[model samples]
Target chain A: MHADPIGVLTGAHFIDGDHACSEGAIAAGCRFVAGYPITPSTEVVERIAERFPFVGGVFIQMEDEIASSIAIQGAVWGGKKAMTVTSGPGFSLMMEHIGLAAMTETPCVFVDVQRAGPSTGLPTMPAQGDMMQARWGSHGDYQIIAIVPNSPQECFDLTVHAFNLSERYRVPVMMMMDECVGHMIERVVIPSADKIEVHNRKVYDGPKESYRAFETGRDLIPSMVKAGDGYRIHVTGLTHDEKGYPDMSVSAQGKLVQRLMDKIRIHADDIVMYKEEDVEGADVVVVSFGITSRTAIPAIEQARAKGLKVGHLRLVVVWPFPEKRIRELAGKVKSIVVPELNMGQIVYEVERCAAGKCNVVSVPHAGGTVHQPKDILAAIEKSLRGT
Target chain B: MPRNEIKIGGFGGQGVILSGYILGRAASIYDSKYATMIQAFGPEARGSACSAQLIISDEPISYPYIVAPNVMVLMSQEAYSKFTPELAPGGILLTEEDLVVTHNLRADVRHFSIPATRIAEELGKRLVLNIVMLGFATALTNLVGRDAARNAVKVSVPKGTEELNFAAFEKGYEYGLQLLKKEPEKILA
Candidate 1:
């Protein structure tokens, strides 16, 4: 469906990534937002607060990140697209609710403008440290979708995709923006409302008395109904049966938990997205994402200049790991080099995917700033020497 | 240009970030080029030495941060002292005459000065001083077009102050042109 006209800022604008992300959320029909202000991520909610009044939306600065995270799920259940924005420290505080959202199968988006570290380290700098956290932060066995945006334009474009994916699978989609992309300003062209595609939650239209909130037919996803829609529905974090009531049987646990896992695991191919360039007949492939992807370009060009067959792979969707593509490249290429702002997070995933078919070299950094192109070039050079 | 990294520095509330925004908007939105601006975000940005880094290129900018700025626009003494050591050799330096005191001038870099604050005061709003410096930059750097810079200034400034800002811009632009024409050797040296 087309976006709402009032929320679409259709023009060429010189804006920062934070503001672009807010526009993206609004364009995707996100009318309710609850967030606690945090550095590098504050501008996102600030812009939402300023623009919500004009776009028939609501922005609430909750008391804390835990409240802010769950409030978005509540808004989602109320028939409104909603999101929350935060950074490293605040993202840590919202982990329990993220698991709650996963267990309850709530549709919402969590934007984490990642900064350096384990505990509030380098609050104003860039880091890809939250990559593993986005996928595994929430406790227990479930799957989630996360997209990393490299530019302000992608910040707008990918955010809408995050909302669409969340609504499609009734999962919490993480918009993983780093401090670099979050603060950098560039020209972002927001298209007209009709040109943008938005996904709305699937609402049930069956008999109210016989409504089953957890029943799945041919499709793995179940249709949803709002709280006041004259339907007898119950949602919870417990392992429940198809009838929406708590079930203690091992079979019930298996059915509910397996569906939650299969909904994303079975649809992994559709969820995995990446950008590949010059991979054919290449001896080495450089895998990177977010700010590191942009920083790796000059180094790739420099490698090409030195008569090396180097290819580039940039991850748009960091979760689901693009294992198929990585395995294919590993079979063809002699080695794969993964560079990131963190010491080593996603690189482990690439290594696992490579699986001894080719050598996997990780170029790691501790995370105050982005990687230097020369460092990536050096890694590429080293990988070639081994082969 | 292959790429030009420009650093605009001053204390907060002097519109240091706004000037970078205008320059980036002019290059990207109006001039059909790519520009990326990254502002310093820390405690210093509140009331102390704040700066904005911009990279302008004919192609899409990949490396967003500035390594060594080839163009430095300084509006405060603190910003000048903190940032001048990193200016690229044979670069362009534009400074406000009243606000910044020129010292330890580099031989390879070209220097140009304009009393942007005085011009903005003459135009009846000191807040438009950044616009004045922006106009001077449009003339000195030749990185952005005149019409593009003018349009960006109009679009970026607050409503009801377009007239005053334009006058301030024109004063700086004319002053830059006259200085270049009158003392090409001294400034170029």
Candidate 2:
């Protein structure tokens, strides 16, 4: 499962987050990219367009975001690992197709370089406002995985991981980035192709006549077959049976929908990823993700300087929200402080998981700029005072 | 160094961002330190106010944006007027002599001026003025080593233009060294 040598760029580069993410996608065996230019995220596709030609990849700039989003799914069905890059406005337009990708179990990646929003608000500024939307934007009860990267290095590393997760679970993966992380420049060292692991979707190997597209083994994830692979298969967005035929029966609806949800839920422990520091016997733990994670570090350090025992929990994977870990930490610590670029999105999830066992403090900001360390330090001190 | 915050400001086409990028590349790549650069983005396309903020530290940087810059490189009158007030007390200020006329300057801050545009013109390309400024900053500020800065300029600029840029850089660096020798008290620690 090692990466292809032609796609990997093995060197140390001083690149921005968007460009690093593009390199990561290329290293992960992605051969198809469809996107519409948008602020903060356009650099990802721009780099792809420049690099794809040499690696036998395709980069298509569609007319609109709606077309760009669904076009990646079509590319996936043609046996190419694919993805699309976008920002807030385009992310909103792609919600329906995200739902469609989930319903059809199309393995793809959606890179949302978020900006301040609620209808074209501060297009060049940073925000984590799309966090809730990425989880619940698509209607229905299916599950998708979302990952947050804090630095240009992680933008290169985690993007490859995002693709692997999508192919393994047969669900769409969201690469949730913000304007700050998207534009910040730093040194990113891409390893050699032999050191990187890439995962491809399992292909159906059974007899063609007995092939059922939706039939599953013990893992609840079915094997896939491409369109031109000399196999007769049908894929639909409606409630379908194991034969991939549209079924209106109540049993079929429950069976199909339940499997989709259970596939991710059952493997939530394996999909969840995070980083923690000094949480063992600490009074307050600061929970943060994306750009806010780096911004919160100075606050954590200042709190520690003042003779306060403060811990930090940075979310590398924002979705499938580390429920078990939060529940465990809530029982041990006196309080938890959550800070984000958006005004109180992930804090509610913290509150829900804490379940009143300890006080939860939310440090909210309406996005354009990142939070000052003093504000987060104040919130951390306040959370401890309430207890 | 614990940490050094730098701000470079000029018009959009003056290569303000690229200067910051070269400095950052020298520190992080050649000197083996941590550096982060963030640029200001807005509706202004070209020939308007633009800035790039950078931080270089021995330890990992937590916050990405610069608070109060310890060093400021201003290439235009507008940039000089806008960014000088935010300079840290006793900070280093480098400006283009012909472009920015400093008046009512702060007594506590150490200031240095060079005709970077004039030097580039003498070398036959005004586009390499930013490279000249980078050389002067390397000599006067002592934030980055001269050899590291030279290597960065070699790799960062477009192919086939290294000779002219290097000549421009050495001219500015020699000018800075002569200025320091004339006034030894202005030498930075």
Candidate 3:
């Protein structure tokens, strides 16, 4: 983690973007993958389709996005951690089932290697257009995890993390990748087998007949009863009680929803991840995510060369928001500029954290391209002058 | 310290990528300085002008691009047109005289036109033209050691293929050393 293997790992060969993400999933112990081919994301499935047979995993190309999403659910229920991969239009079709996974509290991973669209804008170009949708695409009130990575290497490493987080928290984890990072090829070190950490769903070791489906633990996430154990365990998408029976009562639904949200929200500090650089004596800070953040590195150097004390706060893990750190940043810097490939998505989060302690500006650009370094530098220069 | 950004451009078969990678490996594995090589892969990487950005620094590299380079190494005519304009003001341009068949008279840039492709044929391997030009680039910037660049070249290639490439690289080095000792003054300085 300290080295960012893409920058330091000289061992891996220079391969295409698709192969790297596939290797990462294999390393994460993915036993099942269901997908239908899409442009940039197709390579992910192709590489996995080739590798799965050798690794003893199931790589199924379901009829379409609907079946693709369901196959992973069936595999997960069959007691294997699973995943499905897709792009924008495919993702829209899967939202119904995304909501289903939420309701069932089924653990699986969904990889959306995003291309531009409300309805297929650019099939081959890159866009961060899906950021907001990832947080809200699946219908209804449910707590889930979505993490974004800005490079092919993070695409691999974070997919592994996404799987681990899903198993630990018992929820569907969404991996958000834009076309830029999806296509970019950097070095990806296949870590040694002993170096990899894999987490499986917690199984109830008690007597088979005694197991109850919705029984709570300290974290409020229930332990699972492996199906063949002869446990008459009930699972459902409907609002359920501790014994897994439908609860039509308003009070019971309230308690159930609160606990589900609390399981992740209360322990967010443990889940949030971000990186801050050169902030010791800075008056201006640039906050960015995904592809735009890669460009910010150059802007930071340019700003530093001009003798302006500017720093960077980059998001490696987007969800659960990393609120505490941003609030701390709000107190120190005179202003913060959050640049994204969107109009004002993540900037809103930064503004909320600032809370009038300092100025927050969204230096935004959207659609198929990234913000060039000079534009970001211009914003930093403007922020430094208080204009 | 301010780093040097060098952009190498040519059509796909010209070994533009190999040239950039050798420089990156030199700065990284051999010299132990921070370096990065980010290339754009396009349909034209084979026929049209292909390009790659090389950054070598005493500190960690920030920009993955070479927006304006301290050096421009042009292997083809299209490459010369596409990238030569972004040469850092008063920077040096090392190019193949024939590949850049048409010459530009830009007084601001110090141009050293070498017959690199013709020299490669004379040396018996047309593929080694990039290795030859890199000899000139390393000699100019000295950002990464010449020996480091040579070693990076040797290791990158396949077994048994290394011997001829080494000879090709030596021809390039001999040609480059002539530029150093024979020229009136070091333009990079």
Candidate 4:
């Protein structure tokens, strides 16, 4: 569906990533934002607060991150597209609710503008340390989609895509940004509302008496009904049957959990997104995402200038790990180099996907700032030398 | 220009970041070029020396941060002392004449000074000093065109203040043009 013209601010704006993400959310038909003020990510909610009034949207400054996270889920059930913005410390607080959203198949977006730390570390700096946490932070076997944006333009474009994916799969999607990209300013051209596609959750219009909240067809994704729809629907964190009632049986748990996992796993091929350059016959390929992808370019160029055939694989969607593509490249390339702001989160995933077919090199950073190109270059040279 | 890295620095509320943003908008939006701006954060940026780093080029920018700036716009003495040594050799240095004093300046670089704050006060707002510095930089350096910079200033400033900002820009630009005519050898030096 095309975006609503009232919510879309179509123009050539010189804005930062946080503001761009807010514009993208508005363009994507999101009308509810619940968040607590946090560094870097605060601008996303700040912009939402300023713009929501004009567009008939709601912005609530929740008591804390825990309340903020769950409030968005509540808004979702009230027939509104919703999101919550936070950083590392707040992201940690929202983990249990993220699990709840997955359990109940809530469609929402979580914006984590990552900062340095295990605990409030370097509040104003950049880091990709929450990557593993985004995937595994919420304890569960269920899967979620996470997208990484490298620039303010992507911050706008991919945010719209994030909402679409979340609504399509009925799962929480993570807009994984870092402090650097969140604060960096660039020209972001937001297209007209007619050109943008927005996805809304499917609703159950069947007879209210026959409505089974968790019932689905082959796709394993059930249609949703809001709270005031006068349909009897039970939503719970416990294992639920087709009637959405709590089921304690092991078999019920297996069936419901398996469907939740397969809905994403079976469609992984269609959901995964990435960008590749010169990987056909390259000896070494550099794997990176988010802000690190931009930072790794100069290092890749330096490697190419020294007569080395280096390729680049930048992950637009970081989760689901792009296992198939990494496995395919491992056979052809001699080494894969992974660089990120965190010490080593996504690199291990690369190593697992490589599966010893080729050597995997990880250039790790402690998270206060981005990686130096020379350091990444040295790693590329070392990877090529098999040292 | 193939590529130019510029850094603007001052105290917290001196509009250092806004100056960089205007220049970037001028290059990227108005002039159809590419520009990227990154501002410093944390405790240092609260009240002490803060800075905004920018890069403008004909090609798409791969790396975001500036390695070494070819142009340095210093609006305060603290910013001047902290950022001057990092300026690339043979680069251009623009400073606020009344707020900063230069000593042992680099010989390889050309220096230009403007009383931007005083000029802005004369225009009834001390906040527009950054706009004045922008106009001075536009006239002295070939980084961006005059029309593009003027257009950016027109749209970027708050409503009803565009006239004041434009006047401040014109005063600085006219002052820069006069300086260029008076010291042709110095500019070329």
Candidate closest to the true structure, highest DockQ: 1
Query: Which portions of model 2 show Cα errors greater than 4 Å?
Result: none
lDDT of 3 by residue, A2-59 (tens): 2223212235444444556677777777779999888668888998888777777899
**Alpha-carbon DockQ of candidate 3:** 0.22
What DockQ, between 0 and 1, does each candidate earn? 0.89, 0.86, 0.22, 0.86
Q: Determine which window of 10 residues in candidate 3 chain B has minimal summed lDDT.
A: B36-45
For all candidates, the clash counts are 0, 0, 1, 0
lDDT, candidate 1, A1-387, per-residue tens: 999898999999999999999999999999999999998899999999999999999999999999999999899888999999999999999999898888888999999999998898999999989999999997888888999999999999999999999999889999999999999999999999999999877789988778889887656888999888878878887888887788889999888888988998888888889998999999999999999999999999999999999999999999878988998899999999999999999989998889999989999999989999999999999987757
What would the per-residue lDDT of candidate 2 be over residues A180-285, giving only the tens digit for each residue? 9999999999999999999999999789999999899889998999989988888888888998999999999899899999999999999999999999989999
Instruction: Let me know the DockQ for model 2.
Output: 0.86
Order of candidate numbers by lDDT, starting with the best: 2, 4, 1, 3
- Residue A108 CA error for candidate 2 (Å)? 0.2
Each model's fraction of native contacts:
0.87, 0.74, 0.13, 0.85
Model 2 TM: 0.99
lDDT of 4: 0.93
In model 2 chain B, the worst 10-residue window by lDDT is B180-189
- Candidate 2 residue A202 C-alpha distance from true site, Å: 0.7
